[model samples]
Target chain A: MEAIIAVLLILMIAGSIYTLHARDLLSAIVSYGIVGFALVIIFLFLKAPDLAIVQLVVEIITLIIMIAVIRNSSKEDLQERTTVKVEGVHYINLRSALYLLVTGILCIGLFYYFVKSIPGLEPFGVHTTRMATTYIEQGAELTGSANLVTGILFDFRGYDTLGEATILLTAVIGILTILRIKGKKV
Target chain B: MTLFVLCFILFLVGMYGVITRRNMIKIILGLCIMEYSLNLFFVLIGYVKNGVAPIITKGTEQATFVDPLPQAMVLTVIVIGLATTAMLMAIAIRLYRKHNTFDIREINTLKG
Candidate 1:
């Protein structure tokens, strides 16, 4: 099981890297879908059906929104425009190369420190539960729901859900405002 | 152990995208990647070796269930992520409409 999960994680990493570097915006968005779907499978493997369902639906909606934006935006990349065409032969710019080198070094250093800091946390698959033990032990009885996840979400932590709904409402209002045909009166 | 490290690496990959990429849509994609990795990490932390989904169905009353707290939080985060993504997309579309390009480097104007 662990080996399977490791493979999926590697796949997700590769997909994300590809997404960031893909030449075509459409292809990048598609690769991003791959990462999201891999996450859905991983969620299932981790025994979180609730998350899997939510992630799957959200992933699809996100792809639709992104694709719509990409379709309406300029397709040509600035990097492609900057390519130096010397006698019909393209040459890479030195500035982009230098930027890549610097970013790569910084990311590697950050990854190294992150790995070093992982020792402070508990080992995987052995959660301490803390207060969650009660949530699991009596979640159904307290909330009268078959699904413990739903029970805890709507019962034990109902305020958080309320805040989330408010955030969604704000996002909708903000989007409507931003996308208005006219921002100010003439 | 390695899974946790890889999850962080996924996050760094997203950071790389946001920091290095100049396109507005690319930046949004980077943000999405970072969001995903963080959610995955949270769920990963709550995983048990041999656990079932956190549902209290008949005949499985005593089953060891994965922690429900993170799952619940992630569920909300996922929905909120959709909302935020839509909002970001709206802004990006408007920016493209005003500037006629998605490249952030080219869209440099404060005056309407």
Candidate 2:
């Protein structure tokens, strides 16, 4: 399982790099979808299934919106755009490349050091699992809920989940308000 | 181990699109790809060695319950995914009509 997961990560990285360089519109969008899906899987391997689900759902919604907007799009060569020429315009260039590279390297380094320093991480997970099992053994008394996950999501982390839901709702509302055909000012 | 890496690679590819792609549709597609790979990863997370379905009954007295929470959440996630997709598609359609062109470079009326 670990080996398989590793391989998946490698593929995801490669895809990301290719996507960065991709010039075509369709291919780039498809590549983004692929990347989102890959991240979902990676989250699973990390034992954060909830995060994975959230990522998957959010990504799908975003993709659909994008597709609908660009369904009738036509490719054309537009005039060359300049960053400095347009005030307050952020354009892509070699400087952006440096930022990306720095961020990527920093993330990689942080992950490596964090893992190396975190000892007995397995034991920690085992402990969490054991705690959950304990709750299961004493079900009904702990949270008055049969489903532990539900309890975990809705009870222990209720506030956090509520926040997430709110964010999603806000995004949906924002999208609707922006794209509504009634022509009301957003 | 390798699978984890593969998933990461897929994520990176999507990132590539997100970072560099200029077309609206392509950006959306890139987002979708990233979402998919992440979902796959999550489903795999709940899997246990030789684990069986979470259902339990008298017939399978010795059966072990695989964590059902992840699967349940996944179902919900799928629905949400569809909803978001619909919304996105609607926006894309509207944008295309308004701009009359798909090239993001041409639709530069929106200023940052």
Candidate 3:
């Protein structure tokens, strides 16, 4: 199991890096989708079926939305406009390499320093936290939901969910307001 | 443990893309990558060894379950991310229409 997880993590890292450096926008988006799929597998392995389900659906929706946006726009304009040219070379320069080196070193050092303080991985299948125990024991009785995650999302933390819904609605309105054609208000 | 480190590395990679990429769309993709890595880290924090899903079934005895709180929180975060991504893409389209280019280096109308 550990080996499988480690391999998946490695794959995710590779996918992210590939996506970051891919010259084609469409290819980068597809690589990002691959990373998202790997994340779904990780969520399932972590025993969070709810998250896995949500992630699968969300990933597909996000990919479709991004592809639609790309399709609707002038791809040739973007391709020609965004490409960087330095002398005879295109898209590779000294500045990006320096930035990559600096950021890579800084993150490695920061992560190493902080990760030492984190506790080691606990044994699998055993949640030692008190809150988790409490939630499991009393969640059904208190919230009348078969799924504890649903109980927490809708009952225990209903206000937060309400705020989330508001945010979503605001985003939709904002998108419509921004994208509406001029002189034709929706 | 190692998983946390990998997630952090992914975050840094996204940050690198955001800082180095001049294209507006690439920057937005980097932001989405950072959001995803952080969400994965949050969910990993609550994972238990040999834990089952938090769904309760009739006449079934389950010994352990992954923490439901973080799962719920991440769900909210994911939806929020979707909305924000859509908004960002809309803004990107608007910017493209106004400037006729997606390169951030060339869009300098607001420069004082």
Q: What is each candidate's fraction of native interface contacts (fnat)? A: 0.83, 0.25, 0.60
Between prediction 1 and prediction 2, the one with superior DockQ is 1
Candidate 1, position B95, lDDT: 78
Docking class of 1: medium
Kindly list the per-residue Cα lDDT of model 1 for residues A1-186, writing each as its tens digit.
888999999999999998988888888899999999999999989998878888888889888888878885676544423467799999877767776788899988988888788889888888888879999998777889999888988899999999999999999999988987763432
In candidate 1, position B103 carries an lDDT of: 78
Q: What lDDT tens digits, residue by residue, belong to model 3 across residues B58-99?
A: 654556777888899999999899999989998887787776
Best by lDDT: 1
What order do candidates take by DockQ, descending? 1, 3, 2
Better of 1 and 2 by lDDT: 1
lDDT of each: 0.86, 0.56, 0.80
In model 1, which regions exceed 4 Å deviation? A80-98, A183-186, B109-112
Candidate 3 lDDT tens digits, A4-81: 776898888899888877777788889999889999998888888888888999999999988888776644323223
Interface CA RMSD of each prediction in angstroms:
2.3, 6.4, 3.6
Model 2 DockQ reads 0.25
TM-score of each: 0.91, 0.56, 0.86
